[model samples]
Target: MLHVSDIHAYYGQSHVLQGVSLDVGKGEVVSLLGRNGSGKTTTLLTIMGYLSPAPGAITWDGQQIGGLPPYRISRMGLGFVPQERGIFPSLTVLENLTVAARRGLRGEWTLDRVLDLFPRLRERAANRGSQLSGGEQQMLSIGRALLLNPSLLILDEPSEGLAPLIVQEIIAILHEVRAGGLPILIVEQNIRAAFAVASRHYILSKGRVCFTGTTDELRDNEAALHQHLGV
Candidate 1:
């Protein structure tokens, strides 16, 4: 459902993403894996238009989206949950979600369904974003993204800064979303979380793709895991 080809991006002459290419098919979950500074998040930012690619193309459902603004990309059915869990500190959980709601787009993800996916959010409906625990904030972030009813969901480091149990919870929730046939492209340093949800994997090294394979293939390739992912 999404394709990125030969993307090269930079931050004021410091190249961050070089020749990075990847794709996520309909109803499939793919992951970008690597150690810190491997350009995983750079790939995501470029795809989401937070950073523009110098020489590459990003396409969604066969339409080129390279250099499009983030709002435009999001309106076209791309949902993103950043590593920072971008939530409004003063807004109540419900408000944070309702503000992002896009009705009648995909029509499958609603506030009710998202609450069902994350029951904790229901209990914290009146809580402000800054008042929640780290896990609750993450849940709020994911729920807010789902309320957009995106055709493609991209999460950067969903498991970061959470407890092990919370990570498992997030992974289970992601599995449910995938079961409903939403395509996902996740960037994760947590190999275990990535393996739990994604069927395909791409390992990056020094701003370039060094490995691309199925889950089992990556599992069997000890060198790639050790070298690129530091697993």
Candidate 2:
């Protein structure tokens, strides 16, 4: 569904993402795992065109989208949930979803379906984004993205800072969301939860893809897991 090849990105000539590459297949959940500042978030931002890569390409369904604007890339079926959860603090839960609930190019994602995916969204429908719990805010963030009906959902650090139980619920919901038929691109620090839901995994180091393979492949290579992921 998505392809990123030999991509290189920079922030004011700092030169991050040196020849990074990976792919997300249709109806699959893929995880990108690495230590902090390994460039996982940058990779997703680049794919969504938030930061254009200096070299290489990001293609969706075979069309090159390397240099497009962020809005253009998003309109073309890319939905991103950043680590900060970018919710509108003043908007009510429903309003938050409504504000972002456009199907952009193709009309498939809807608020109703978003609530179906997250029952808590229905329960807190009237609360402002600031009034919701951290877990609720995360759900709202995910719901907001779902309303876009993206062909591929990119979630960066969805489990970060949440309690263990909430983390488990979020993981379950992510698995359920993927089961509902959309490809998922997850960048997570929670190795166990990430491995549970991801069909394949990639480990980044020094802003490059040092390892890429199925979950089982990663599981079997104990040394590789320790050296790259410390798992």
Candidate 3:
């Protein structure tokens, strides 16, 4: 569903991604694993056109979408839920979701569908962003993204700043989304959350891909996992 080929990104003269490449097939859930400063987040930004790739191509469903603006890329069926969980502080939970919503090819991630996936969101339907707890805000963010009905979902650190129970809830919701046939690229530092959802894994080092394989392979190869991820 998505292909990133030899992509390079930089902030001014500081190169962040060096010929990084990976692919996510339809209905696949892929996790990007590494310590801090591994360029995993940079890869997602480049694909979404939030950061320009100096070299290499990002193609979605056989069409080139590398340099397109973030808005345009989003309209082309990509949804992003960053670590901060962007939400309008003044808007009610429903209103915030309505603002980021869209209709996509699958026609699956409707408001009702998302509400079904996250019943707690329905409970806080009338609450404003500022009124929500951290976990509630995260749920709102995921629901907002789902309303877009994206073919591919990019989640950066979904587990960050949440309680363990909330992390499990988020993981469960992600699995539900994956079962509905959306590809996902999860950039997370938490191994438990990543392992719970991702069937495939990629270990990055200094802006380059060091390994890409099944979760089972990564688990079995203790040396390789230790060499890069320190797992």
Candidate 4:
């Protein structure tokens, strides 16, 4: 569903993504794994059009979208959940979902569907974003993205800063979403969570793809894990 090939990006002349290439097929869950400053987040930002790639192609469903604006890319069926969990602090849960809602191609993700996915969100429908716990806020973030009805979901660090149980819950939610056939590209620091939900993995080192394989392949290659991911 998404392809990024030989993409190079820079932040004011400091090169970030150097010839990074990866693909997420339809209904596939892929994880981009790397240590801090390895350009995993930068790759997502480039794909979302927040950072433009000067020399390569980013294609969605076979059309190039290298320099398109973020909103335009989003309207083309890509939903992004940043690490910061950009929910409006003053908006109630329902209001937040309603504001970003967009009819998807399949028309499968309705407000009720999202609420069903996260029952705690239904319980706190009236609560302001700031009033929820970190895990609840993370759930709201994913829920809000689902309201967009995106063909592909891009999540950055969905399991970061949460308790183990909450991380497990998030992993389960991702598995459910994957079962519904929504493709995902996740940038994750939590290796366990990433491995749990991702069928395929890409490890980046110094702004380049150093390894790409299935979960079992990664499991057997501890050297790659330690060298590129420091795991």
Clashes of each: 0, 0, 0, 0
Which pairs clash inside model 2? Answer: none
Give the clashing pairs for model 1.
none
TM-score of each: 0.97, 0.95, 0.95, 0.97
What is the overall TM-score of model 3 with all chains considered together? 0.95
After TM-score superposition, the amount by which residue 11's alpha carbon in candidate 3 deviates from its true location, in angstroms, is: 0.8
Give one digit per residue, the lDDT tens place, for model 1 in 123-158. 999999999999999888888888888999999999
Alpha-carbon deviation at 23 in model 2, angstroms: 0.7
Badly placed stretches (over 4 Å) of model 2 are 103-108
Query: Lowest summed lDDT over 10 consecutive residues: which window, candidate 1?
Result: 100-109
Instruction: State in Å the error of residue 164, model 1.
Output: 0.5
List CA RMSD, all candidates.
Answer: 1.2, 1.4, 1.5, 1.2
- Per-residue lDDT for 52 in model 3? 87
C-alpha positional error of residue 193 in candidate 4 after TM-score superposition, expressed in Å: 0.7
lDDT of 2 by residue, 51-161 (tens): 887679888999999999988888888888988999998999999998897444446667787788788889999999999999999999998888877888999989998
Best by the lDDT measure: 4
Model 2's lDDT to the true fold?
Answer: 0.88
lDDT score at residue 227, model 1, on the 0-100 scale: 83
